[model samples]
Target: MALAFGLAWVLFSIWMSLPWLTDLGNLAHPLIALFVLTFIAYVPGFMNAFLLISLVLRPSSRRETPAQWPSITILIAAYQEEKLIGETLRSIAALEYPGKLEILVLDDGSRDGTAARTRDCQALFSALPNMELKLVREEHNRGKARVLNHGLELASHELIITIDADTRLEKGCITSLVEHLVASPPETVAIAGAVLVANHDESWITRVQQWDYFHGIAAVKRMQGMYYGTLVAQGAFSIYRKQAVIDAGGWPDTVGEDIVLTWSLLRQGLIVRHAEDAIAWTHAPETFTGLAKQRKRWARGMIEALAIHKPLLSMRKMRTMFIWWNLLFVSIDLTFTFAFLPGLVLAFLGIFWLAGPITLLVLPLAALWNLVIYRIQTRMLKRMGVKMEKSLSGFLLYAFIYPLLMQPVSVWGYFAELFGGKKQWN
Candidate 1:
């Protein structure tokens, strides 16, 4: 599959580089534009193919255990999360760890009853004998990074685990993450745990996000782990060595503190590993409005991180390659979505002039590629024991339609970041 994608990408690149293909006069204007647009669309297809192949080929191993279980401080950064704070606290209180665990809920000046809700969950929080729950309230909205830094100061453990207020951990999440840190010694500074979509069964938006979590996000993390340079430790669920984070200047106040912190740790010669088995379930936005806002924040934050760390763009630094790969991935998605409508218009027009044989040949090929990807994804999910209530229709809708709808919003995010817009955490 990788070889086939490489060959296709090379051919597509060569075809696009031809002056006649891009030149308006060489062919009918519409046809010329379609050809160029088709080439543009192929870039993302090729990149996805490459990523899928990489994920399928990556090596794996059983989770390892450490000789000693280290103490951990779990930090939950919340702002106006009254509805969800109880669940988050309960999940942490249920973690099956024998070592001392400190759970800190930092309410970043929520006007809502988030702090009161945390206090209400005290009974559950106190149920676990080894765990202690503390509430840290801020006078103002200082953002996630600052709240995290404050939690860091109060942490009584060597490892600091940061999770969003809406995130819930699986039974052994903490044990699995901290074990890797202890076994690897000083080299491993941060470990990114896998995050699955929790509200996936609620709406189409969340369902699509679930597939994305499995194929798009987790697949990339798997490949990144092979290189020992996992770029981002998801803010929702990640474990960081306390001293290493402090040494790297605690999480920098950026749009994407997770990515910035990961890059900073790498700069200090610390390894970042992906813990595939350490799973956490997070609630995704249920509506398009919520989804768009989330994507915009993510895209803007990423751009902000890239701009702030411009020095890391040197190819001499390994982070440069990762950054470039990420940029290419985002660009391909943006360009392909923009070109789809125009490409389809030309394809319809060409149907009248071009032979039926050509149309039949191309259409099925495109459809087949999509089917193959879906089947691969379905099999992968079933193997991982992820069952969906909706069947093939849901998967198809998620794969084809969601990306097109989300692309423009992401592009808006890129531009907003470029122009120095603030991303509201709430």
Candidate 2:
């Protein structure tokens, strides 16, 4: 993902350098033309090319496992999530890994029946010869980082897989992830799996989110994995080498501990790879407010991780370049947006002569780019065995609108991270 963004910059610069494209008219400042064109031409082209190459280059099948399967401990962390915890547990119990596996569900002092649900799952799944599920309870409500750190101490195996309480794995997710790990080199410490929206049929918000997951998160991970640049081992469904995590000091106490943990591994020169075939379905925020809060928390986490890992900002490595590029590009985009809006006012007032035709060209170009991404992601969804929702047409129509709507939200996230105190998990 980081590498793609860097390449996007290089690719877009090449696109803008074409004399025929930029010779439309003269501007008071050349960078105004360059920055405007970056969003209009460079972004879409980069995204399309990056996604296609990543998917094409991704490993088609899991490598064959060795004769002896390794032992793994699956950790489930719950905080006030009583309703969906059982289903998650059931899914964990139903996983079809050939290796030895045990599940431990830690209750983070839920005020409801989360602990009871955990007990129920423990009793139900423990009888299975292969599935041995255990229940752990914390006396007080602490954050997820504390629970996971404690889990590391209790884990009996050298490998740990963390699944959120609201997540349900596909039958073969664990097996696939472990296979990917076995296939990975010793320096690669973790693998992040693909996460799909389970409630995709709920609404347009969720449907687009489903679309975004496929195009945005999954595709970007594949690109990063190609170069060992996988940045974040997302907590929803990820596998880790237990000792590597222990050496990195377990999960960091941050709003985005998962991302921070990945960065910590990178600081120690450990590589975090990604496996797309390991699938987990999760519930997304269906309401607008819920979605906004979720995006805010996510943005804040990225900001916090970047702040905590400042030493890597200039390490002259691919991963460092990726992080530095992301921060730089976000700042650049924010600047372009501020200028472009007033530039729009100037164009409407007939001050900037070429702005009209350029605007006309850019919108369709952006939509066309999204359509290309949609077709690619559609194929990925089919191969991943995901069911297309009833609102396929709605998703198609909203692809053009999705990018426009996210601008303010992205800006809000940056501002919130800078000024907001004590971020809450919604």
Candidate 3:
């Protein structure tokens, strides 16, 4: 077939054009090395652009009619969330599209008054008709995977939404997410909620993360949601079609249960969509230590999630490709994290000057690319009608500083998870 020959030719051409690794990494010209590295690295990004364009053109499942409201259960796993759970319960009681809803809160051995607060909320929402609240408690601490596995079994509704205790739902969030699931084909198994950092103004660390979530995750989810195989349907605010969860073997006991669940659903050839309109506000870590711990847990969990799923065997091309993209970059990301900038700085100190004017273009060109990425994210957020913070400082950090910061943290996470260190969640 002409198609097979064309593919072979393209592969051969690319292989022939690639420079030897040792020569490419330590070139005579510092700038040329940087440029060459950048070019080869972004080859994947360019290939992924086709996938992004496909999703952006048709962000939804293309259904326009009203979907019938279904009976649903919202599940929340709580620890020391006493400060936030009351408001979370109130937000659920305040749902505008209250058809038939049951709320289940699992108090996973919190030493604090998290259990008592839920009881108070139970009394508060007692009069809210068609809304049921079931509170469960564990005498001691167990991991999130265990808590959620139990919650999924306890839930009696056809549709289930998993929420974090600290998340506050916007008025239309529940309605929008459920409707997106309802409108989707029966094979469309889960929906991811757009998570915005509510505590962005609480501290400098939170402020930095605010833009990262808004500008980074918001756009990434929209693109990934295209074929309904977004990597992670976050536990913070995710809706699922129940039978699909049962079919996918419930939530697994991995550091990253949410992502593993998403992968499992995809492996089974079910869809996991992103409902950008279904908004949820959750608190971010307000300190560097806090943020690092959170990221480390997430990173370690992600590695574990990837290991457990080992998705290449799946017959679905799109799902396999998505997993492959994430898996493909472990060594590359670590290389850039440790070597790239440090090498450039050391080269300058060692009097390794640029060979020509061409090498001087890397920094400015990279800065421009960052700016473009931020602007695209801003436009996406505006399209979704999410509010943007007016901090020029945050915007600048988002464009330049955040990428460097994330790399080291991810590296630390990989090591920590591998070595069995750092395992506490607040």
Among these predictions, the greatest lDDT belongs to 2
| lDDT (C-alpha, whole model) for all candidates | 0.73, 0.74, 0.72
Which of the two, 2 or 3, has more lDDT? 2
- Candidate 2 or 1, higher TM-score: 2
For candidate 1, report its TM-score.
0.85
Residue 226, candidate 1: alpha-carbon lDDT: 61
Candidate 3, residue 398: the lDDT equals: 65
Clashing pairs for model 1 are none
- Ranking the candidates on lDDT from highest down gives 2, 1, 3
Tell how far residue 294 is off in model 3, in angstroms. 1.5
Indicate the residue-level lDDT of 328 in model 1: 65
Off by over 4 Å in 3: 1-40, 43-67, 313-316, 347-388, 422-425
125-168 per-residue lDDT for model 1 (tens digits)? 66677889999999999998899999999999988899999998
Model 2 Cα lDDT, one tens digit per residue, 1-426:
534653765565565455623563254456666665565445544545554555555556345586788888988888888899989988877777877887888888888999888887777675678778787899988888999899989999998999889998998888778888878887989999888788887877888788778666766677677767788899999999999999999998877889899989988888888887788999988877788777767777888888998987877676675676456556544644565556566888976533444444344434554555566657756776766564675467456656555655667778887887676543
Ranking by TM-score: 2, 1, 3
